[model samples]
Target: MTRVCRLVAAALAITVPAGALVAKPAPKRAVAKVDWTRTFGTTSAGGYVVGNPKAKVQVIEYGSLTCPHCRHFAATAVKPLLANYVRTGKASYEFRTFVLNGIDLAATLVARCNGPAHFFPMADQLYATQPTWSGKVEKLSQADQDKLNALPQPQMMVSIAKTTGLLPIAASHGIPTAKAQQCLTSQAQADGLMQMIKGGEELGVQGTPTIFVNGKKVPAFDWASLEPFLKEAGS
Candidate 1:
């Protein structure tokens, strides 16, 4: 059994019916195994970038698209900070995927479906509309257990992603074919994502949306309080 699947099983054992308990199976996917290439500097699909290339502060967020906390940060804090700092070349931001489940991975794929140029915009939209889509996940999952519960599950993911404006962008960008391919099939990229998660752990990140300033970890969420740190990083 893959470590992640075992972890998932351990978690499900508590919430699911007794019949759901079973030996953990290897995840059908080892990690995304796709050929990925970036056509621009500081821009990669399924990733993020902001601020000047020479900016001293490099903030990397390892987030799941479906995570409410991540969405909250994007909506309530990150947006304003991006406008102030990222647009002014004072700080840079990057997002790495950390899939918590099949549904989360599906949502990530949809967010990345617009390639790099539209990735963050799609993500921003997703975060903005998170509550609506998040509520339907359970309803959508139960509608067709076979169709939805199956691994490599599609699970009305497109429907939910569309609510966030990603579908239209997908149509415009030709579905971020290469980027989505990289995310869904590339073992190396998957491993790289895992490494980022490990890096976050080493930095004492116990939850999603942990913020950093100038490569130094910040332990709080209050934007007003973090201003001094941002000022120093921006300097």
Candidate 2:
């Protein structure tokens, strides 16, 4: 089937039964019950971290707000990762910013506006609705587009956020327009985002959704590829 479906099926195959010719139901795999009290906090680099602070395996995902593949991975992989690994104290997960463009930068700012507690959920919302917000640019007139392109970097980001409906998305997630505007205009936030981008570059992140397990780059790019690494590390 499609790539995402294939990836998901492969992921399921890890825990689910492999037989297809037989008519018997597959045996259920037992997942550890989530504690729901796992630690959540901000990393020194401004990324969000969730799970046991001293877990043996650490997963760092460098993702762009504008990347569809990153969104797909988030949708299909994160839930299981959190439940089976992070919740069980087998591994910890962190998300790092890797902005691909101005839109990505703006989205990152808005997502981080509410701080660490809201960061992951806001990020999930942004990725789930990425196409809606990102597609709004194509509907703008040439003059308007040029004006947007001509604004100072911070204001340009704010304008992009408003134009692309990202502001409303933030508001719905508890950040108001005024506060979001402030976040978009914050020089400190901009600097942090830039630094994150630089850090991603130094880590050799050539694309969105680049994952690292225990400081080693994951050779495979999908959930199926990552599962084995997590298992090996956790084991």
Candidate 3:
């Protein structure tokens, strides 16, 4: 028998009565306390901020909804950053939408529709499912593609959102189909996203997943490069 089994058997033999049935020990429950210091809000620049409002280091990430690199970074780096730096009040993180196309704009609209409380979570969900939805658009028929392109920008975005499965993804995130469609068609939301894209350009953002620390752009884009800047700024 294995060492663990032997230990269990020894304990059971010592604790049980001669004629009694052996009872299994209960599973240990996880008791880790959740950290609630992380907070969220919309920025004047039309971005979403998550973490301590008064943190010493400020980290801003310019990301696109349909960008694969952005999706990878969100999946791999964001949670650790939130846990180690943001939760510890060493840094504040902000994510600004840098719409790369009509589909990106549509996705951002649905993500922002649920307000600050749900913004980050919705964005995370969109990034996580980016491949599945984007793949659907890649496989569309030529005639259907042309039809989508023929519509006006707003209508085209709504059509793309529905066709590419983005609407369903949004619906799964507690945004109803009607609400998602309305957000996709909202000119105000579209313009706001556009303004943020322009703002990113003005800040010299040349690509998705651009990192800024304390109002200064980081030379490299990955989390490995960005973390040191955050530590230096926080120090």
Candidate 4:
């Protein structure tokens, strides 16, 4: 890990053998630890996190769902990031939404359907299918766009979700169309997402897919540039 690693080093957790922390008696053979990759939590900054909470290395990403750079990074980085780093319990990964616009917010709400455990999978699928739907709304006539922008919360979300195909993508992830709409209309959730944008601003984030390793901003914009940094950080 880098110098920034020291900042969080104070959070170190004592290590014990697998299942040692539980009440069950020690087994004849070692019981494997629960997969850190499947574990999920929320960071104080409102980012959805996965992996060992006390991992030595920390990887945080702030990005806009509509940003092509973010999509490209997600397309390549996600699998290996989970497989090699987060899953190993050496690092944790967190994604803070950098809301760019109404469409991005709608997409995020739709992707977040079913709650935190389903968030990553829905987001992953959204990125994978981005090329298919991300551009549709952009092609709207100026008048149509004006109308969409003038609409209120749930209506705007409904229009954007339908136009961008977010509804179907959500459906594919087991979020029924009605459930997706409910997620879209959630005023509290939308406000929380907006707060995440403000949080990103406090961190001096200026663009999509910003990477922070152990609290240090790194110049990694994609998987190729990011992998080395994570590896150097003990990934």
Please give each candidate's TM-score.
Answer: 0.64, 0.81, 0.81, 0.82
Clashes of each: 8, 0, 0, 0
* Per-model RMSD to reference: 27.2, 18.1, 11.4, 17.4
Q: Write the per-residue lDDT of candidate 3 for residues 1-235, one digit (tens) a residue.
A: 9999999999877865665776778999998754534478888998999877778888899998899988878876777788788887778889999888777877788888887667787788778778888777778899888888899987988888888887777777788989888888889988888899889999999898898889998864556866778779877
lDDT of 4 by residue, 75-116 (tens): 778678888888878888899999998889999988777766
Higher-TM-score candidate of 3 and 4:
4
Each candidate: what lDDT? 0.60, 0.86, 0.82, 0.86
- Cα deviation of 214 in candidate 1 (Å)? 1.7
Q: Who is ahead in TM-score, 1 or 4?
A: 4
Residue 105 C-alpha lDDT in model 1: 60
Distance (Å) between predicted and true CA of 57, model 2? 1.3
Q: Please state the error at residue 1 of candidate 2 in Å.
A: 93
The deviation in Å at residue 14 for candidate 3 is 47
Worst 10 residues of 3 by lDDT: 32-41
Which window of 10 residues has the lowest lDDT sum in candidate 2? 13-22
lDDT of 1 at 141: 41
Model 3: runs farther than 4 Å from truth? 1-38
